[model samples]
Target: MASTICYCLWFSYVTILHLVSSLAKSDNYIIHMDLSAMPKPFTNYHSWYLSTLSSALDNTDLDTNNLNSASSRLIYTYTNVMNGFSASLSLAELEALKSSAGYISSMPDLPIKLDTTHSPQFLGLNHRTGAWPAAKFGQDVIIGVVDTGLWPESKSFKDDGMTEIPSRWKGQCVNSIGFNSSLCNKKLIGARFFNKGYRAENPNITIVNSARDDTDGHGTHTSSTAAGSRVDGVSFFGYAPGSATGVAPRARVAMYKAVWYDHAVASDVIAAIDSAISDGVDVLSLSLGYDNVPLYEDPVALATFAAMEKGIFVSTSAGNDGPDKPLHNGTPWVTTVAAGTLDRELRGTLKLGNGVSITGLSVYLGNFSSSHFPITFMGLCNNDTELTTKAKGKIVVCENFIYSSILIQEAEAVGAVFISNDSDSSFGHMFPSIIIDSMNGDIVKAYIKKNSDSTASMSFKTTALGTKPAPSVDSYSSRGPSKTCPFVLKPDITAPGTLILAAWPEKLQVDVDNYGNVTLFNSFNIVSGTSMACPHIAGVGALLKGARPDWSPAAIRSAIMTTSDIFDNTGRFIKDVGEGYKRATPLALGAGHVNPNRALFPGLVYDAGVQDYVNLLCALNFTQKNITAITRFSSFNCSSPSLDLNYPSFIAYFHANDSSSRRVQEFQRTVTNVGVGQTTYVARVTPIKGFRVSVIPNKLVFKEKNEKLSYKLRIEDARMTRENEVAFGYLTWRDMKHVVRSPIVATTLKLES
Candidate 1:
């Protein structure tokens, strides 16, 4: 009964400036044991580049533009001290590699660092929000960050204050690869790896391990956010920072490092997808996506579709695709999210007192008469359109457009009074005087539009006081119903994917008080990104998993979506995809933001399981024909009419279609009574006339949590007509009446005599 919410985040960084992450000692399981009887992990050691270079390079570097490159050459091919060879490499070997390369010098340092100072953002998002009402302090959840590699021993993943990796992760990573008791127990972290294709030479290769040794840092942040147990309450990090941890705290992780590199080749992703299903992960969160070819192109999509068939809920970011040029992956099975900023009690405001005030009214050459003020910036006060003072003895009014520096200098120059501005560039800090939103400015503009006279008085008092960050949609979150795409909805829902405070590398903690600061060195730094928000969904997925281990991925996704809250904390519809624009579609926030509480008991959920998806592919001939693997349940070329997709599906209509199509497919599911509608509703399946489907317990009743219900469906029919097309729509049950649908869940058919 104890479950919590957590998330990873997405972020953009100038890699060049921040890549110099410090190096930490590697945690080598083999370091302590003797290896005298076996060969070293590598022979004639050389990274891929070095090995390739030896075969190509010949002459040493000569004078290139008379540049002194000797010193630079000695530091070539740098690897993080956290890498495999960093600590082991002797100075001689390091120097030799450095001397070998001419153009290249030291290898780029990982752009991560340690900041022990916890950020206020964490409290604002997790602790104060009550988003994780059940999450407790010190309790741990072993959430897996299944991505490319984790480089567990890297500088950023260390335990010391120098960087800020969690002690739980470090403690477990020391002796085992993943899910180990001593190292990976309690609050431990683990990883795995997987490959998509067979070895090219033999066309037969078995991927032994998919342990994460991160080539990218994405996996690191994601895992941390999903189940990072708190160091101390006030220094909280993940949403599930306590005992009744993430959806499933007692749940161990199965990190299947399956990344379909290279813009995503379908066949490859499928392998990982299949592996995850086989691994039986409770919940899967994918912070990746693609643009084209429906949600079925690359293997990731296929595998994701496959995993759903196996009941693995998948979640992903809505892509950074924005208003102008958008792209996203919005499959019904996947839950997407768009970003939204938080607006707290504190907001940025500007006020000007005696130090700043408007003297009087005057029209500049720019607006009143473009001729004299064709020049936008200079020549204001005197020659443009100076106005005489009126009543109240207040400062004079003037047109806004004076440069900020000019306004400050002008206010002082015109010792007569102070100044005010309406339209400027940045936020409140753009000018020295008081500032208001353009809407406030429009009030003045609207009055001017009506009267065109300066006699109307608009008085105001200024008292600027507080300054704090409010949550609103981030300016960079992507919008959806992707461009060049019409059917798919994107960014299913958004979470707190921004600069957040969490556990950091312990070594980095030292730098805190070194400069004399309130150093809670026990904690690490603060950060953000969609990568952070991902775990929130993942953790929720885990909670759902704890309830129904056999639920299909689609069902889980449906549970999360159907339960989503259409409103925010203030009871307002969360609008704006992110930044400052509308996405122009419902897909921008598919099912709205996740409502985990509702998800705990969604009234009804759409089902998409691996078997169902695979069967769907078989129906469409998308799956490869497996002669030996084919069973009696499987069918070959069937005669079914080509689909007329002008309807709801997103395929093109064509001739030469199978008129007689019959296949054996199944979708079995169970729904629980989650709402308080105590009335027992009658059961009814619609499209009552088309295709054929039989249900069990035709009518049933439910009362509480430990509810019970059952149903079985078998399809038998063969026809090709408009009726078939209509049936391809969704099948629903309303009170007692209902409708039948195709593409999986309807009683099937084959063109028969």
Candidate 2:
């Protein structure tokens, strides 16, 4: 009887707890307000927000004078990015906010994911001459890195040769439990963090303090890649051993910690960006993004637009969801970069008993016996029970790469082999392992089938440089044909993002040898992703900014895009590693792989200002109110609407089965001469089979530098026979020393009439 009574009380307590949880169902929402509509009597926007929140609660007795009273609900008050605040609101509270004055729009705070590095010599950067000396190796330029914070003690952040901090810098190193202001120096100028939105979303998470120190190696790697100091004799477990330096070694770095762990709240990211803008960073590098959303709705897009208007160049990653559509960061103002393979490879070889040698990729530093071991195939190795039974005392061959290296070790396997199509095989396994392509994997499988006993031996990792057909589009790098705005080609350029060695947190272990011992070089790590590609562009942009301080953000982007390389080091068209090694199109490579040296002196640039982007939004049917919400403009007229954005590339869309005899589209563009002296540029168009492209007046003659000229391109598609087909070509404007090229993409669609 006593036990029954106790059980009844326990049940009643759980029932009451459930009721309270249901009553307090709330979510975080970012609320945008009209700064122009604020009451005249209120001078502080925070006070106004407090009163608004109190009014929304219908609490007449609450004190609006005390700002800290609303700290539990108020997540962040954004000032620079937008006139807004993020708060934890319930369904009924959100409805009340909608009816409140000055309220414009509200969106639920979403989650964003974090998306690295290489030798400067691979991109033709020389220390004594060329871009390095011309740009002073990006001295005194500030690059704001927004990601998972950074490791302040890394050798790549040493300021031994750095000059004094730039006078324009106004940022500070926020003090927390583990990090302090004194940790910052001349090289790493500032550090800050935003976690209010994160804490609000995860109410149960215990945050010690708001510290901007990198725990995950991503932020440190990316920050170091953009503008890290030079470190001699750096390597990742004895692979790629040599001196390591970022693209721009002397550029000052500032850390804005927005992400926590593997993901970040959009509201926090916006807050970080807002602070960066006010802090006067010359360039913003964000290696994080979310799913493709409308420009007006995406907080990162809105914040980046504000940054662009402030003359800050923003470089973002083209995501890692590759060989797929609808990648993020499609905004024209931001330079979206994609991942590509470097000329370097960490190579390993597998020798089968049948006298067949297959070359593959691996970062394993372990050694195996020269004697061959019996190998058996275990499809995928996802099931522990199956692996335990079939994988004991033998080398296991799996059909795909799995993240759980512990499973293979626990199954008592001598070694493991993965057959994967991914171009990035930089993962260093805890055991002896190597990843081979599917075609070579089939050969091993056939060898096993033909012989009763299949034996194989693997070699240790070795550094190999100057691999042919490099700068190929990586298989994991996101592809384009921007879903939101296809007129502007996405993935503005490509850079080295595969098997890159960059600085890492020393406490982290990324590689292990055969004996399950951590590798020695913990200060650097090998990683790959478009996250790595974005900073390469950021570093290059800093170089350009330092060389040409008068150039606008648009001009810098135009130079990078217009002067990129369409061919590989071998003088062949760049190929897409994801598409069965086919020739990459504009949709895959944008203008092409970034040629930093060539970009330094692009003869002509297609420039666009804020008004041009506004015109683009107008062409896309954005309302005046929507424009105000995004741009913070009080009054403006959508007087001109045109799809022609004066971009560096041209894309014309057509219907696959339009019965009309002729389908013609025209685009107008203006180019400004940026070369040394007066010169004339002649236009040349590469012919496409199904389309005819003509440039009006076919030549642009500029008498002086900075002179502007206008031209119109007319493309006529006579027969659109294939459905969903794309034709690629180029339009080049050549002078004595510069070849300003633009990719011409003509895509056929099945449009509903």
Candidate 3:
């Protein structure tokens, strides 16, 4: 799982100089400058950037009153991810810096956003039998979370009944405000904060009072979802009141607070990755998504690549920007996770006077009756001033998700119901409110239309288990065609992310009352996004790591992907909730919903090494100079075809001259026998309707463990009947007990006029 080479054409010295000179008139720009070569590992490469900038901009002196101030003007320099520095500087300053001999090309520093977990029983990992106890519950693995911050005092981070921290752990819990060495035990092993990039972006902002304490509950939720301690009687006001345990409850966590309320800067994220890698984390879980850029250029991706090179597995969120734009977290080297539904849903039902009951999702702690009052529209209240007088003491209906709190508290409404266009019904307002989807909202609206007095009583029920037809891809979960790398399938796997009840910080506020009281709930919360999904897989990766200490990052990923299930609990193919209830494709669900039990014992895995990506760079036509810059190894050469990288998943793209030409594509794949020795597996294909697929040497025999064998898959497409067509299928190698599945996709571009 080394850096998956993102190749681009090389820019000549004159072209770079010309581009830099043209930027002299700009006021401010955020640029990522690539270095001519990677700096020495574990060294302060910031000094290299400082020296280069100082020499290039000899006419101007830096204002170095403090490191933060200096970073604000000069910007923070990154080393571990790539030997480059990101800076906020003037056009003239950038031009002067471009004169340095070490400069490569500079690109815009894209802004990123938070992409923002679940029942282990649903995935069946609670038993002592099977691979559950064999994994030792991932007690030896360390999961590093790069998110908002951590709340060390939470019960989830407690270290009761745990062994000492692993001696391989090299990280430390910095004694920041609130976060101290005492708070970091065997469970919560490390804690650190990064904000120089945030401060550089926001000049006047300061995070003074609380350091490393999760003012926002995102970090605590994700971290705990991955490897929180097993705590009994954990609940959010009696909702999900059971023994709360993470996917890997015994695994230790190292918290890296990289995101701020204002921004999750690329520079800060890269720095956190650098520290986490140096700190020797076993698995890195990042819930943030950078802007849509080439995979090689993304700072986080590059840093994660370096981490992967060190045998650390990395899992990232697929992003919540979905339904239409799902091509996020497209890097093939890291495990990109998509959010899926769970078997349990917290449902709230409204019993109407007309003998109709409607159910939706909500975490409402208490139930109340509003049958005596007539339900009326809140006059489309967008703010408190917009609340109508007639709406007082009534079950007011609001159109938007944001205005319910105002209508409930300030307007004195007896209850509030949000008529939402979105399908997700999970509500967390500090009021007796339930959001009804459009279909049910229409039913409620029609009852009001037929009767003058529309009366309804609301009651919140206990968690509903065995939710039929569950594990659907969340509507908001990003879909994927891999815009950056179309040949690669994105969102490497799916996990339970929707309405996941996990640990939450009591200090964070999701809502407030009109009386100036901040509403805070302790212990647990239900949050949805790929952010939650990522940690689930990270925890699973830790479990796999604990089970197989010698497995590479690629092997871990291959195990998860190959052993996953594409069908839901109902035995039908999983469906994407956002795709109009249509059957899910590999583009949406990746290899499919993760099967933790099966992943622990994947029989065969497609193993890839650092040089595999170097060959891909060669196929992409990257210059030898750029290759040396990224690999840091002089005299490096790419010797293999890009499509022959021995990846677990395969994609074949066919080019046609008018949809009439016969097109054939070839893909080579190799798998290592990780299961039993002296076993033979046969290749099988679930061919697409319009494609003819054949696998040469369909049967593979392995005499020893860790033995590698290769096979070639050839696909021939029939006459393309449509423009810009895509066909989905899968190729599997089956031995008797294990199904090594790989998703196969073929696409044809639209003919140009």
Candidate 4:
């Protein structure tokens, strides 16, 4: 009885704490402010618990003290705004709200909960590391996925959390909706064509009823990788698993169909960007760009620049033409994400020479199943670098790293029976690829070297295989240092952009799958790409922006870059990304993979703001020649280049002078956080074993909450004037009297003369 009473008291206390917000939503949908405390919203997760807050509003048994002490409580509500809306933001309302007493103090950064899993056409790459560290819950930052309209009811994409379509996108009424095919009916969604950038009053576009409709299904998959909620054990594939979710999930999404009928033009893309900005989206992730495309001088390039100027962080695909000439859209300006393979083993095995002799492991070259032909294991190649040999009537087992397509054409054509590929990135091991049981290739080599003769006499065995069924980075997604524009490192970074599943048309699924015997959890799929990673980054951006509402775009980027994880599975620095020649190999991380928690407390950040971008565009002179690019859906505005995409502070940077090439100059970001209370703390710098960090001032102080502090960090060493190098280092503090902490860097720098 005592225990029961205590439980009841606890329940009452928890419920009472949310009393204020309880009154706002009669439904049990409650929202907690603390990033750590917030629970994921489920189609069925909050149905019952929500009553506690709402019940009090009706009755008067609520305890005011509990409500007062609760950090923050908000009624969760979603409204469809696809079609045009009559509501207007009055200037008076804005002024009054800004003037409101507690407004400034209470404001937080915008959220980054993008819906990455909207399409089903991803490669299902499961990249779940080197991302922001939170409870792993999705965030609530709004993203404008200007692609196909979302069909919330499809069985393949049933679990999508879309509440309703937007009002502004209430396209021409349609009758049917679908998922598999392009257009099932018109009334289901609101789709308006904003394509074919022309010099006319209205562009050649049409409006049709749709449910976030998609034709190619690419956009749908991309969006899913960004924000699809967890349904199965963890995630479909992309990063942000467990308690750590996408940057935003509770945030709104504005979907636009840009590449309808498998076509995309500068006008269409520009219109989409303009439309997104007008809709007030926080970030824009577009995984589309072309080679030999125009520069900031071109409409497409200029459009991208404009978006950045508006304080919006634009993430584009680095382009697919890798290991080839004329780079893809791997420009340094955009947050271009590239693809890399993940494996458990450093070496693999192949059957060369005889019909039945298992000598040792070789690198994977493709075939794994149905080995009807004779096979033998070859010995380990050196350093697991390159493998060579002659296999006539036998099979060759190659480690992943080498695209099977090449081996398929070469070996098979020369009388080789079959091939085996070893890769382990969850689902990325499709086709002939084999998984290398958690052990690395080095281990396999060591084992072979230890038992050289025994293995040489052994025959091929299927038992010595590995598998993980999760997706991995696609070899064909795209590469950076864009061929067309090598000066700019095409893809700035990589994120989860692959085979993803999101909200699909309800009418498309025959019978959606459910968890156990329930109908609550619906919709899910696998995916891959920079598209996937873009939303992941965007979500982290939202979280950090929320924590430090005043940070500029550049600052956010800097936080993500500097504090990113910069090591490979082997704990070594990722190698040169194929193209773009830097006197030195640029770190795989232009800054590094994003670290949201670290970003929240990053001692320094490069601040990119809208004004900074304006200056960049002004000097570069990237202006539009036509006005019809904007949608009729929005009230058009024409002004100087100052009003382009609110470029974040970081996007404002330009190459230093005296060089024809637009090379980036050196810059640094410094931060000091109160990891503790009032007095000062000791500072230290211990970089990752293989990396180095240069800390300026070397030591600093951290104040308590409600108190602000500052520090001075030098850019380069006083002894030498390095022309174009960023001064990198770590800043640490321990046993401080006040809040003090150094940030997390992915690597330790090796001193070089």
Task: Score every model by TM-score.
Answer: 0.46, 0.80, 0.78, 0.50
Candidate 4 displacement at residue 565 in angstroms: 2.0
Q: What digit string (tens of lDDT, one per residue) describes model 4 on residues 74-139?
A: 222111101110111122222332332222211222333332332211112123432222322333
Q: Which stretches of candidate 4 lie over 4 Å from their true place?
A: 1-140, 147-215, 233-249, 260-263, 292-295, 298-301, 304-313, 321-334, 339-372, 376-528, 542-552, 567-587, 617-753
lDDT of 2 by residue, 1-753 (tens): 999999999999999877655434577888989988889998567657766765765542222333233434665454423577778776556777789899999998776210113457778888877788999999999999998888888999999978888888899888877787898899999898888899999999876564454457888999999998888877776677777789999999999988887778989999999999999999999998877677777777889989999999999999888886556898889999988888776767677775455566788765678788998887788889988998888888888676545688888998888898666776554577887777567767777888878898877656656566777998888877776667788878888888778888887655443444445448888888999999999999999999989999999999999889889877889999989778998877989988888888999998888889988888888777777767889676578977789999998888777777448989999999999668988999999779999999688888899999999999999675577888989999998899999999887843222
**Candidate 3: worst 10 consecutive residues by lDDT?**
63-72
Models ranked on TM-score: 2, 3, 4, 1
Residue-by-residue lDDT tens digits, candidate 3, 1-753: 133332222335567777655543333333345554535651334445655655545533332221122223444343222346655554656677677666776766554211112368778786575445877888879999999888888888888888988887889988887766787888999998888888888889867434464567889889999998777766656555577788888899999898887368888888999999999899999998875676566776668768888999999998887777755767667899999988776667665665455556677665576455677665356756656556677777677766456555577777777876444655444567777766556667767778887877777744556555778888888877666555667778999998777777776664333243545556677778899999999999999998898999999999999999898877889888888778888878889899999998889998888888777756656566655544556676555558466777867767654564558878888889998888999989996977888999899989988898988999988766455666888998998778899988777743212
**CA shift of 144, model 3, Å:** 1.3
| Candidate 3, position 474, lDDT | 85
Judging by lDDT against the true structure, name the best candidate: 2
lDDT of 1 by residue, 1-753 (tens): 123222211122334223321111111110111122223442322233333233222232322233222221211221111111111222223333455323133332333222121211322224433234433311232344556544343232223222233343321233334423233333334454545343332245433343443233455445555544333442222211222122333344445455523122344445555555655554566666666554345444555555555455676666654545454555545566654433211111111221111112121101111111001112233432222222122223233434333433333321111233221112212122233333333333333345433222222211111111222344455654443223223455556554443334332331221211234332333344455556667766665665555565556666665555445443455555342333212333444555555565555445533343334434444344331132213453334322111111111111123464433223344554444444354444444334554445555465664363544444434343342232321233233322111122231222211
**What's the true lDDT of residue 272 in model 1?**
51
Residue pairs with backbone atoms closer than 3 Å in model 2 (clashes): 116-531, 116-532
Misplaced by over 4 Å in model 2 are 1-117, 353-358, 365-367, 377-390, 402-410, 438-454, 509-521, 660-662, 750-753
